[model samples]
Target: MSPRKSVAEALSTRAAILERSVAIASAEGLEGLTIGRLAGELGMSKSGVLGHFGSKETLQLAVLDRAGEIFRAEVWEPARPAAPGLARLRVLCEAWISYLERGVFPGGCFFVAAAHEFDGRPGPVRDAVEARFDAWRGRLRKEAGRAVDAGELPGGTDPDQVAFELLGAVMALNHALQLHHDPRAPELARRTVQARLGRPAAVTGQVHRDPPEPTTAPER
Candidate 1:
């Protein structure tokens, strides 16, 4: 039997391969990322591709995981420094659109492509994708909760509903952008979300502030 790869080495190689797989998927859609293409791109044999992932399904799952990591780095982690609340929620909504606009996937968003590909399929690939969905939705809800706490949004704002709307808007823009290379659809979505939930608020028990008076110059 061939010698076993060390744990550390195996992990490192897997990471590299997963990263490369995403780049291929981003360029050619997940369907385009075949063992042959990956092998050629990575300068490895088809057998080597099989070594990291014994099957295409397994490779798909690994790609999703690595893609999630990329998403976190590009969007989620950056939002952490923003104070939690409607502002954070607003920032997150914009950030997601920006990520799509930035074109992490040359083909468009990976999650968007995978969701359509696996919509009706029941398997580890779908399961893995759903796991990431749950995480994203959860983050939205948590961010919404902060908005409500800070009075940036209506006290009655439903975090789940808010998150859903935001996510749906992103999807709408994603399709629009993919079709026409226009950015407005998603930007509109983000603006709508912020307009709905974000604003300067009076203190919990204080009266609303009036508009500021215009300043006048006595001498020119």
Candidate 2:
């Protein structure tokens, strides 16, 4: 093959490997990934599979990266165009529900499974998983804060708490779908999310307080 063609083939093979890796990792946990297994399933030689990633850790990291890309495409990008603050947050939540409902990964969300599998472990893989979760929570928190600033969410609302609850709701959706196979899980999650966002948080500590009422009524 020409040098250009050889490079193209190599790229194609790498993409195929990562695609299969993400699917396998989603259903079986990242630890379930092995060069030999992937080689057999993809019809590639063991050496060929290992040649792309060099080691299992590298392969796992690559799979996490690939899964992240898919997640952004499915869950984040759809919400990107919405108005920032509550509008964007609402869109993000809706997309998140759809992502889980559609079963984007053969096993629910890839990060959810990876999070459970790697939570107790310590290493690059575990760090990668944690980092992804942190970033996701940060995004949620950021939008929630903006909503509060924009007077969309109650001033009393805690963005971090909102982020936590939102993440928890979707995580529960994953659990219900994966473990109990609950058919109402998606809609149930939607209702839970909507209710959580719709209800104003009660005043708690020093940081939370009710928004002051408008001094004068003018516009309709």
Candidate 3:
């Protein structure tokens, strides 16, 4: 093959490998991804799979990167155009729920599975997962701050606290959907978020204009 053809083919093969790697990691955790298994699944030789990533750790990191791309495209980008403040935050949360509910990954959210799998392990994989989580939480916090500034939320609201609670609700949603097969988990999560943010319950399709009341709700 010509040099151009060779480069094109190599790129195509790499994309295919990464695509399959993401799916496998989502369903089986990053540890379950092996060159032999991937090669067999893709009908390629182990050497072929190894040639692209060189090592299992590198392959896992690549899969994590691919998962992030998928998340941004499917979840973040869809909510990016919404006006800032509560509107944008609400859209972002809805997009996230939709992403999980629609089965973007065969195993639900890739990061959710990976987080549970690698939470105790200390390695580059764990670092990557932690970084993603931190970034996501930071974005949520920033949006919460914006909402506060816009008066959509109470002026004294704690953005980090709000972000924390929202993240917790999402984590619960994932667990309920994956472990208990709860069909109402997403709706419940949406309502939980709406209530947390001082918005009217989503089931009513109404917005509350008053500031959120102080409550002794337990932190999730």
Candidate 4:
């Protein structure tokens, strides 16, 4: 094959590997991603999988990066064009809940799974997860601050506090879906977030929102 073709093929294979790795890590945690396991799943040799990633740590990091990309695409991109302030923030929260409900990851949220897996361990993996979370929460706080400035939320409202409450609702949604398989978890989260932001009751009505489309990603 031409050098360009070889490089293109390599990139394609690597993307496929990372995609499957994200799903596996979401369901089984990053520790479950092994060269041999991926090789078997992808119908490639162990050395082939290792050739792309070099090591388990490198593979884990790549999966984390891929997960971040998926999050931005599914969660952030959809809400980016909404009118800035509480409207944008509400759309962001709804997108997040939809991301989880749609099963973008087999195990719900990749960050949530990886965070619990590496929360106690001191390593590059944990650091990567922490950094992603910090960025996410920071965006939430920034939007909340904008809402306050726009008078959507009370003048006395603390952006950090609102971010915390919204983040808590997401955590609750993850727990409810993963533990009990609750179908209402996402809607419950939506209502909780709307209440926290003080959106009008008529706007938060159940009939107003459509359910998230089911995801094509693999399930556990």
Measured by TM-score, the strongest candidate is 4
Residue-level lDDT tens digits of model 2 in 95-159:
88998899989998888888889899999988888888888888889889999999988888999
* C-alpha-based local distance difference test score of model 4: 0.83
- Model 1 misplaced regions, further than 4 Å: 1-13, 199-220
Candidate 3 ranges beyond 4 A from true positions: 198-220
TM-scores for the candidates: 0.80, 0.89, 0.89, 0.90
Name the TM-score of candidate 1: 0.80
Better of 3 and 4 by lDDT: 4
lDDT of 4 by residue, 115-186 (tens): 889999999988888888887887788888988998888899999999889888998999999999999998
| Each prediction's whole-model lDDT (CA) | 0.71, 0.84, 0.81, 0.83
Question: What are the RMSDs of all candidates, in order?
Answer: 11.8, 10.3, 7.2, 6.1
Per-residue lDDT of model 3, residues 123-163, tens digit only: 99888888888888877888899989998898899999999
* lDDT over C-alpha atoms for residue 201 of model 2: 42
Return the TM-score for candidate 4, rounded to 2 decimals.
Answer: 0.90
Q: Which ten residues in a row have the lowest lDDT in candidate 4?
A: 211-220
Q: In model 3, how large is the Cα lDDT of residue 112? A: 81
